[model samples]
Target: MSNEFKDILYEVGENAVRITINRPEVFNAFRLQTVEELIVAFQRANEEKSVNTVVLAGAGDKAFCTGGDQKAHLSEDGLYGPRGTVGLPIEELQTAIRDLRKVSIAQVQGFAIGGGNVFATLCDLTIASEKAVFGQVGPKVGSADPGWGTALLARHVGEKKAREIWFRCKKYSAQEACDMGLVNKVVPHDKLAEEVEEWAADINQMSPSAISICKRSFNADSENIRGISFMGVQSVKHYYMSEESKEGVRAFNEKRKPDFKKYV
Candidate 1:
């Protein structure tokens, strides 16, 4: 709602509100505060009468978002500030995006990895730049999004492709992502912003009430994933406490491959 956010930039334009993660120093990685700010921003946009579309983006050219700030999650007591089952309130953030009556678009310019990938998956449509790279790194990092990040993603790209994404943790280029049904369109890197604005303008010309009902109708099919997200995050919280999970983080910070097999 407020434009004075410490971790993100919220701007209201003609008929669209853009929320950009402003943490390029850390690849736009989200911490507790970042997630909280995002939730508030999305909620604000949802309430704004003049807004017909919400554009979710990240600052800088290097990344759209790399996911959770692992450094902030290092402390065992407060994983990312003890706000939710996983200490990130990620479920709430996801729900905020899902429940928004306005059409949501992911303006991805660079890396959309880990939780970032989930955000892209959750949006109503995704417009990517030619430079974008998309993937999941949860298994590699000793974590996994058990709900919408996984189940909803499967719906977008199919179960087998989704499994390959999560299990293999490989990065896909923008064209590859578009080919797989993940991205709606891919434009030149320099034209990314212009492309998103055009799409938003087109959406704004449509009937708001019709769009709202259509969005709700589409969401109804996957509404059950919300419940799955709740319970799955609880399980993730427990998994975070395990040595296996910690190993992943440690290995990441130490710049080495995790020895998850040893834990197994």
Candidate 2:
């Protein structure tokens, strides 16, 4: 295992590579450097011949990740920048998650909120702790866009549930997420690592080439429609940057609920 200052650790063992988010102080909140490191880790895992499967987990007991670093996102001028242009560079993180060829699993332990939830859903499979809580809190934080979260959430839980999650910023438990098909499995906190390792062992026993091909096939089918939908949704980001979104941000920063009633 290799340790780093940023919120990432890379380890290779027993035909599997494990990447852990290492910032427990802030609930493993993402910084821009963390995204870059994760990209590097994913590339390394993809290129390594000895690694047949990849696992993602967060360090500590509290949270997998709470999402973007709000303090990091606040500029010296005190303004929130556009989604990918600020904080953790979510687009790059999403691209890295999307590029993993080996079977990937997210072993989520606790809070998986906002961009954190997006990160977990990007994996091929998710094994969550029974105590974990997941949600998209961007809306509450004054962000109009959910980044790549919309794509994966809609695919996993369908459009209505996805809309409810993002629009309402409601938190759901691991069991609720599992019942809604957002997670593959939920195990006790103590069993998360063991269960993930067992699953990875089974995956590692498969023919690497065959597993890679199967992953690609399923990934393409799963993402094709959502990709097109994302393109369309992304085109409207400029609208999110307009006065309405600015007002949303301002209202949030001021600790008052937005007055969108007039727009309604």
Question: Largest lDDT belongs to which candidate?
Answer: 1
Model 2 poorest ten-residue lDDT run: 76-85
Q: After superposition, how far is residue 108 of candidate 1 from its true place, in Å?
A: 0.3
**What is the lDDT of every predicted structure here?**
0.93, 0.76
lDDT of 2 by residue, 117-163 (tens): 88777888999999999998776664644435786678789989989
TM-score of 1: 0.98
State the lDDT of candidate 1 residue by residue for 135-156, as single tens digits.
Answer: 9999998899999999999999
Query: TM-scores, in order shown?
Result: 0.98, 0.85
lDDT of 2: 0.76
Pick out the ten consecutive residues of candidate 1 with the lowest summed lDDT.
73-82
